[model samples]
Target: MLQLDLKTTVFLASIMSALMSVVLLSAYHSFPRSIRGIGQWVAGSLVLVVAPMLFWLRDIAPAWISIVLANGLLLAAVALWTLGTQAFYGRPPARRPAAIVVVAATLAVTWFVYGRESYEARVTIVTFAMGIFFGAQALLVLRHGGRDFSARFFGFLLAVQTLVVLARGMASLFAGLGGQTLFAANDVIQTVYLGSYTLMDLGLSVAFMLVITRRLHVELDILSRTDPLTQLLNRRALYDAGQRELAHMAEHGGEMALLLIDLDHFKHINDSLGHAEGDRVLTAFSAMLKRELPAGAHPGRFGGEEFLVLLPRTTMAAALALAERLRATSSRFFGRQVADLTISIGVASVDKAEHRLDGAVRRADLALYRAKSAGRNRVEAVMEAAA
Candidate 1:
């Protein structure tokens, strides 16, 4: 059997930690700027790389430098990991509290190093503090991270690392800190502790990168499908979704409706109030659609100043009522927020024999043209052929 010594394990762990830090840095530079938390993770991994090197220095350096400062770096690394998790979830990183905890833990380790020189006390304190941070990471992921494989994998790693750290802390109380000096004993507990720490160091670094990559992919997907300014489904995505919905309704024998809306005199608003004000109006209308649209309604930005709404299992009458409601509310909203603006909506329902979404949209477009031709700020509907 090949035995792994504490010094060899620590040295290997330091090398691996530095390599992982490089990997994270590369990913941060290569990936989109929208992905968060990689910077903090990189910072933590670099700190971890330094920490094990100091541990390897041990007797060559003073106790305060090798033990206290090294342990302080370890605590700081955990704190940074916690902060990274928070940043990934778009939550505020309460830096003051984490900084306070790291400072206090370092002071406690310093006391054990110089004041009394008890290895057991120092190991116990450091392990317990580290366990706390690991536990926090796990809990945060469980609460906020979505039900995705990357999230679960990362959370599980954090949970297992927490258990390992806590077990080491408990073992330190009974195991007498390995020997007169730290890592002096070649016992089973010490060997397991060092081996597990190294494994976890590598595992967690990879896991953090996985989480960041997954988020980057998700952001890119959303960006591709959504309008940049309004954050609604873009024209292509809207058409795709409409086709899918229409196919489903065709197979299931259900009615569907389309509403084509155009903001009246939108160009005038942009030319007069500036494009910035026009964007605000569009964003506000998108928000209103998100809040006011009924269940089973899909709203999208078809083009500039034109929006589309798809209503599944809806009749022409119901679609007209909904359109009126939207027109009235939008008039009031824009009146208060921007200028006295109004919208014209054209509604159309699917024919029982027709399964295509484009036909309904075309009819709705015609109705919208009529609405604009007659006057602005009104609701019009083209009945299905069956009706």
Candidate 2:
């Protein structure tokens, strides 16, 4: 195995951390601003970049500057990492609590430097503090992080770092730091501790980037499939979902139903009340669909002021009942802003023998036309199979 002196290793680690900060900063700009944690990670990496340089200056510099300040900054870096993890998960940051913890840990390190002068005491204190920070971050990610490979990998690395840090703290408290100077130890634990810090720093930075990239892809996928205004599935997604359900029915011998809905006199509402209020009515209707639909129902915005729903395992009778209920209840969703808004619906059902959605969709459209012609705000259905 290759070996480098502790000073050289610390110097290289500082250089590596500096380079990692550059990478993180680049990522911060590359990712969308809404992503939240890249900025904090960049700050944490920059802080870490300074800590090893201070550690390398230990003998030449005053103990307060090299030991106390270095350890304090180390603790602060970990606190920032915890904050970044919180932000990544969309949790409110515990800034005041993290500040208190970092400050208290720094004070403990300072007291040992100025008053007690115990090397083992300082090592134990700083390592334990780092363990707490890394452990908290690991918990936050592992518990709430999405079930993706990048998230699991990132959380796993943090968990490993937490265990390594806590193990070192225990060794310092019980077994001692092994020598007067950290480098003097020439011990396995010391080498592993320093090496782990450097490698974990690199691994975690890359892992965080991967996590952010994965999340960006997921968000973009959702954006492509959903309507921006109503946050419901868009036309393409609705068709795809219906096809899948149709395939399932073909195999399982079940029935499927659809509802094509239109907001009555929506263009008048837009022209009279302006697009803003028209948007409110659409949003209210979408929210009502989400709240009132059954578990197996798939709802989407078909177009302007038009929505479609595909309900698997539902009969035409059940679908018409649901449409009636929706028509009756929709008025409650809008306030005085659009008090007179109403919806008309067309319901159609397909049994297992039917394989295509277009025929059913066409029939539903015709039914919708009839409902609109007969006077709005009524439910209509086409019972016959389309030839």
Model 1 worst lDDT window (10 residues) = 177-186
* lDDT by residue for model 2 (240-354), tens: 9988998888777778899999998889988998999888778877887999999989999999988999999998889999999998887555444476678889888875677
Can you tell me which runs of candidate 1 are displaced by over 4 Å? Answer: 178-181, 338-340, 385-387
Candidate 1 per-residue lDDT over residues 17-52, each given as its tens digit:
999999999997998866778889899999999999
TM-score of candidate 2 against the unseen true structure: 0.96
lDDT of candidates 1 onward, in order:
0.87, 0.87
Residue pairs with clashing backbones, model 1: none
